[model samples]
Target chain A: MNIIVCIKQVPDTTKVKIDPETNTLVREGVESIINPFDIYALEEAIRLKEKIGGNVTVLTMGPPQAAEVLREAIAMGADDVYLLSDKAFAGADTLATSYTLSKGIEKVGQFDLIICGKQTMDGDTAQVGPEIAQKLGIPVVTYVSKIEDIENGQIKLKRMVEDGYEVIETETPLLMTVIKEINEPRVPSLRGIMKAKKIEIPIWDASDIGAEGEKIGLSGSPTQVVRIFAPEVSKEGEILEGEPTEIAEKLILKLKKGKVI
Target chain B: MSIKIDLSKCTGCKLCVKACIYSAIDVVEKKAYINNNCTLCGACVSACKYEAISISKKKKTAFDEGDYEGVWVFAEQKQGKLAGVASELLGEGRRLADELGVKLSAILLGEKINGLGKELIFYGADKVYIVDSPILKDRLDETHADVLVQLIREHKPEIFLAGATSFGRSLIPRVAATLETGLTADCTGLAIDKENKFLLQTRPAFGGNIMATIICPNKRPQMATVRPKVMKRAQRDDTRSGEIIEETILNPISSRVKLLGFIEELSDKVNLEEAEIIVAGGRGLGKADNFKLIHEMASILGAAVGASRAAVDAEWISYAHQVGQTGKTVCPKLYIACGISGAVQHLAGMQTSDYIVAINKDPDAPIFDVANYGIVGDLFEIIPVITTKLKEINGG
Candidate 1:
């Protein structure tokens, strides 16, 4: 089973702050890390590889700094890492991003399965994995929470839906987007870290992947961000004053008034 | 472009009546007549087998900015019932439609859901599109996208809105991609620019730290998915009436993925999305065992239990119950925080709740800033007292 895990480096959104004066994201001091969900995807891929004998290759599309996540994936258990980084790839939307990633996959060679996190923290668009499948003419399953079995060239899995999980069976050469419920990701061992340090990650540009220039970046993206500003926080609660009992009593009356009880 | 009726081929089967989403078509004396409300969606044209109705072909570019009309809300339904967010989108969609001087319509796809179409009309929709098929009984991304994309291409609505539920989040993006249109996700605010008639889609970015107002200036139909409970639902009025048009799937494409069965997560037995009240815990609870107090208080109030990222990261609670940026965004009627300091990530998920009560030992916790009522005391001391008083109030 040759599995390709797609990962991304995202800003620690929790630490991200908005500059009140300028109304812009204060990203200068914030640290970047592997998108938390993608770690689960990588771990699932590694575990699958461990169970059945095969290699796990990690792929990502971003600026040069995104290679850090590739190294991190390798340290965890990925056998090889490829980075699709270029100025032309900047400012891509989900459509363009997925197209570029698909081109990179075509260049990287064959694979039985492709895996990705449910979404990226910054973009939060879960469309890429399915879109890539559509563009590749392959089948896809989203919000997969568990892999039940993989045999006879077909895989059975559990997919999360609105109310419950759906057990699905599909052929190989398929794509799936997994959620954090799937599995707990493993930490990097010292030996794994050393091996990752010695492996040189290859950077692929639009030309390297034979991608069309118009379909690789800002030009290819159909949507544009017109404006960004700080969301106004209108929380001015009536702070109840008094002893604990008094506060509790006041809260009950308020809840009744709000029809919440 | 406009729909043309062929009087010679007219059978007056009335199938077109059920196919017109806008109630824009009526049959009078064994003939079909197109009304003024029609946006030329061509559902009736497709439903007529004898080619009695046809839309005129117009040569134009893909981004013909002037051709699109009306506002549409994707009415999300689960288990044969419409989700609450559908009404909220209608509330917002009505405003946008009125501003644009266009009609507000809802597109519903499900099996045995014609009843929901009338309900949508009662909740501010001027027209409801119904596509009933066994293939559409369940929410599948590819099938739903195919049906929606077909309808969108035939009848171009200037703005499309859907709730950011699991179904909406999974489906809308695929449709948008297939149509080569732009889509903004998890929008908190949606408005129309009176000047250019463009949809102003505002959503929180960077973990709700800032708001980004996005616009698809060149795209024909601007698309967006809104977070549930953020928008107010339209007031229900059964006296109101509208049109329900049944549509047909020209070519039903079977999905390659086969669903065997479903497994309900034990931790999520009580869905947090529909819970009226939520009692959430934080790291200040000290240990996983301390969550018993939080659960006890919740049980007494008949509320669901939630946890902050800290508690979930500490392995005190399952991720299913975590409410934060990375967790589920909930908008219950009441949210009570115990020992929660209210990190912005945590607040982003539940700040929209109608009422909030915070309890913490620290007087300066940020949770108090957003709490409607605050108790600056140890939760261990305060929670049990509140529970006891609540039981007394309820005579339990």
Candidate 2:
């Protein structure tokens, strides 16, 4: 079995701090790590490869520093890693980004299954996986919370919905985006990290992946950023300071005045 | 690099540096240089006072932008009832329509949903197009996208909007991809650009750390999805009338994925969306046992219990009660956040509540920023007092 998993390197948003005075994101000390959701995708791939006797490949489309995440995946037991990086691929929206990734996936050779995180932390637009499937003309599903079985080239899983979840079955040459509930990602073993350091991962650009220049970057992206602004935080709210009972009385009176009680 | 900096015009005022979320720009020797960390988000372009930065746009597209007309709302339905976000999108679409002097249309698909067309019309749609069929009853992305895509192609809407629910998020992307148009997700603000008359879609990224306004500069049928509770619902006018067209599915696409069954987790009693008052807990509650205080307070006030992702991930509460970017966006009459240090994600979900009360020992918690009333004390101390006061009122 050939399994390819797509991942992204994102600044750990959980650690992102905002400047108290300016209300802007403070970038100091923020570290880049694999998107939390994609860790589940890579982990599930490695587990499947272990069970079914196959190989797992990890791919990321980012700057050269993004290769660090590929190394992390390799340490987690992926067989191969590829970095799709080029200036031509910069400034792409979900549509252009997915198109570039799809082209890169095609160059990685045929695969029975492809896995991707539901979304990235930085973007959080869960549109890329399905868009890639659409661009590639393959069956796709999103928000896969579990993998029930893989047999006879068919995969059964649970897809999360608003009210609950739905059990689904689909045939391979399939792509699915996974949620965090799928699996617990494992810590890399020392030996695996040693192995990853020895490997020189291949770098693919727009040309190597056969992506049309007109469809890969800023020019290819349809959405344009008209403006970017920090959402204004309103005036500092009144903080009631007193004993618990007095504060409770104050709050109740205010609620009554506001017609909330 | 798509962005080019003209050193001759460089002032090194550092305004663009302050505007960039990525910290990709730095002034060196009176000129600014962009690093690889930049994704060309174009935030710097607007921040520069000197016009030192320029970006290139795509020269051509598959279709002429003038071919599309009217503003559209995807009227999503569940169990034969229209989703609340549909009404909200229609309300927003109505504004855009009036601004551009164009028609506002609603595209609805479901079995036995023809009657709901009147409601769509009342909510400000000039035209309601229905594709009522059994094949679309199951809410398969491919089936629904196939039907909606055909209508969009035929009608040629200039702006397409939908409620950013699980169904909308899953289904609309496929339709956008099929039509080869641009689609923005989870938009919190929508407006028509005054000069360009383009739909300006504003959304939060980096978990609500920054806001970006995007436009489909070259794409026809500019599409976007606004999160539920983020926009106001249209005022229904029963006396208003509009045209309802029964759209024909020229061809139905068969879905490769088979849905076996749906398992419902939320009970009807404590529906967060419908709850008038909500008392929420977070990691600061310390343990699952302390969470009982939140439940007690909520029960006393006849409010629903809510949780942050941390509380849910720690197994103190079920995910159904989770409120954040990854969870449900809720707007209640009164929201009391207890022991919750507000993260941006958590704030994204419940900031729109009519009245907010926050209780925590740490006064610096971001939750205090949005609260109408704030109490700086241990939740254990403050909640019991509040609960007792509520009980006294209930007894009287």
Give the winner by DockQ.
2
In candidate 2, what are the lDDT values of residues A1-261, reduced to their tens digit?
Answer: 899999999887777766665545666777899998899999989999999988898889988888999999999999988999998888999999989889988998889999998888888889999888888888888888888999989889998776677899889988999887788889999999998888798999888999898888787788988876676666358899899999998998898898887
**How close is chain A of candidate 1 to the true chain A, as a TM-score?**
0.95
| Candidate 1 chain A weakest lDDT stretch, 10 residues | A19-28
Which candidate wins on lDDT? 2
What DockQ values do the models have? 0.28, 0.62
Cα TM-score per model = 0.87, 0.94
Number of clashes recorded per candidate: 1, 0
Q: Per-candidate RMSD vs. true structure?
A: 15.3, 2.4
Model 2: per-residue Cα lDDT over B34-150, one tens digit each: 998778988788778799998876456677767888999999998798887788888889989999999999998989999999999999999999998888887788888888888
- CA lDDT, every model vs. true structure: 0.81, 0.85
